[model samples]
Target chain A: MSPEKVQGGLEPSETVAIVGASLAGGACITRLRELGFTGRIQAIDCDPFAPYDRPPLSKRFLAQNTEIETPRWWSPDCEVIRARAVAFDAQRRALRLRDTSGAERNISADAVVIATGAQPRRLPIEPDGVFALRTAGDALALRHAVDAGAKHVAVIGAGVLGTEIASSLRQQDLQVSMVDAASLPLVRLLGRGMGARAIDWMKEWNVDLHLGVRIESIRCDHGVCAVTLGSGVAIESDLIISAVGARPAVDWLINSGLAIRDGVLCDASGSALSMGHNVVPRVYVAGDVASVECPNGSFARDESWTGAKQQGVKVAETMYYGAQQTVQPEPPYFWTEQFGRRVQILGRVSENGAVSCVKSVPDRNGGLFKVAESGAHVAWIAINAPSLFAQVKAGLLP
Target chain B: MKVALDAKRCQGHARCAAFAPETFVFDDEGFSRVREGFENVKPELQEKVRRACTNCPEGAITISG
Candidate 1:
């Protein structure tokens, strides 16, 4: 559909209520305004601060000792509501929200966007020294704890966020130890060989690696945490950062009657999919909270920064025009910075897929690896070689 | 209209090239660059090009007459 066709049927006076005013929510409202949707836009987020970029939380914001300034994204024209969306009444097209002051109200809208992102998964045991990074405030608090003489740090989980946090803490001259249930860090995404290579980098950075172990219990005393692993080893550290994973923040939608599995179930076009294979009209899902079913009958949730933003744009277009006008699905792209190297991956890299080095750089620990399934190229991984990644990406295009 | 890409702000998201491959191409470093001789998009393809600019998460693309 053409840009003008986006606003074809919708009236400018229509109200669009968006929950979770983070990256995805911000992108949706911005795209709507840019497309000449002169409707009343209400952005509701539990965060008291305005919408800001999140990528910095794990990197620059965590390492820096000084105050880190948040970069705002919402425009002044949008109404920013600092409140928690408690429930959604789809039949009435209304949302129940509770403000920080403990006041509750119901606001009706012509359409609703469920951009409520994911929250960090907590361990079975809750202790004072355990922390998870998901927001600007979390980063600030972690940094403060480190600055206040947190010498030994133990990071649970070896995923992108966990490893990145370990790298940042190591940069701050703290002793770092990493524990993960997986055999190797990122093995599920990068495959075994590449994951092993990443482990080598972690070891070189002096991070104590405790793989294939689960934290049985955590005991905190006098601001120090003693994490006991399944192997019966107790690691004493001043702070514990749990980068285990995240679950879609869909507790509020439990009674809302939305079909949720892993996340809010949606079709490829970002329209909420009900249990009976019917579209939940006037309600859209995006960001980490959305699990989109692909044409291949598989469901995938892209929690990356780029994925959330693209999903936001698609959801906006679908809401404005129709699902028939949805943009074409692009290959999944993800990047992470850890151990002073930038790792980029395009396409899906299955655990059992065969991988081969497509290109290499001299004297640099970087190369392009092509992952294939039964001789068909399915994904590409580039380590510290952005130029090669660009070349491979161009070759993937038709 | 002339389409320009702000390379400094791009963090290799590559949405521009993903959406409008004919008009935008990624350089060696994975950053976006307008395809050769396609700096000024044709009137017929302007809408598609505009979608690419609109979808960029970094807001690094600009279209001008």
Candidate 2:
């Protein structure tokens, strides 16, 4: 859903207040109108510019400083609130806002969609040249450093985000060293062998790899920076990137008095599941701020673009169709183009290094590994080959 | 008796995944994705499943033997 679509959902909505004016919020608004929702639609975004894509902040946006070529990922024109959300009143169905002037306005509505997204996790030690890759503002800050051709960047995590950042930095000729506490670059999810392959790729690119180590503290002085490891090794760096992880953007809801565990907990239907299943009729949460409950009653906090968009659509469906229609969890998939390899994984991957078989595509120098016991096909990961990925994904659907 | 997750809680935390990965692979979110031979699982494998339950960070698994 884009900005143009959201403006259309306005006619049907008696009064719709989307607390988040970003991607998910923008998409929800567009989708609602697209589905024939006609009512008052209000989108509140903390950032001045209307919603844009964030994934690029780590890759293309960093590699190339060009604005979106065409699809803005938003409608042509939507009322972007450019205001920060301060609080929420579930009973009154109003959202508190502090505009650029610092004036407070309690905006009320029939449907309140909370889409306040997560911010980057900052390190406690605070190295002078340290940075994060979350918001566009953060990207701009890092972009200057990259454009300035700052050499020798130390990426603090081996996760996808960190790896991508490292790759982008490397493309700019900055010597990058990716250090992680995990045994492998992607140890928490992909097993050690997969991690080894990641290391192999990084090594091929000459990005220094420091696996199975902990950074005790980071210190910076003037233009130089250094990080001390638990092993008593000092790594000198020009820039330090803390790409550890992210927590929920649940501060406003925390004082709002709604049920929150990690994030605003919602049931399978996207409704605020107060006290676990006695659904509140009007309130809803979507995106990084919401904890979606699977059909089995266990909740998981997701901070991915796909999860946010999928849940945003689901929330709209639940509102229009009603809660009885259950939406099963879709297959979780994410991909990254990094270090001269496009790495993609579908289905679940074991961290303990389990491999049923690795089928190689001799032509492309890639292989597809079948995760055993995963039914007909659990997941298929491909490196540098997308055709094989498609074949496996299409065949995996039960 | 041994317990298994309902495929939802099994977000590959893999705490319980160490048991018999050949028997318990995961869904994209890292949960117990496949339903395998809980009945025919070897004794040691069953015990591994029990340990997975203990290590699960989200407390998404439980086992009895």
Please tell me the TM-score of chain B in candidate 1 relative to the true structure's chain B: 0.91
Give candidate 2 misplaced runs (Cα > 4 Å). Answer: A1-13, A68-73, A127-129, A275-277, A322-329, A356-358, A362-365, A373-377, A396-398, B1-65
Pairs of residues at least 3 apart in sequence or in different chains that clash in candidate 1? A387-B28
Per-residue accuracy of model 2 over A89-191 as CA lDDT, tens digit each: 7777878889899998888887778788787777677655678877778888888887776788889989888999988888877898888888778765455
For A1-398, candidate 1 gives per-residue lDDT tens digits of 46555443357878999998888888888778766789899999988655777776787667665344433334557899999999987667689999999999999998899999999998778576688999878888888898899999999999888999999888888999999989899876687768878998899899999998888988888777888998889999998888889999999998776788999998887888777657888788999999988889888899987788888877888888754464556678887777877788898788778888877764567888888888898888888887777766667532
Cα RMSDs, all models = 3.4, 14.3
lDDT of 1 by residue, B5-61 (tens): 888767676667767889987776678888889998998879778778766656678
lDDT of 1: 0.82
Task: Looking at model 2, give its docking quality level.
Answer: incorrect
Residue A132 lDDT (model 2): 83
The TM-score of predicted model 1 comes to 0.88
Highest DockQ among the candidates is held by which one?
Answer: 1
What lDDT does each candidate get?
Answer: 0.82, 0.68
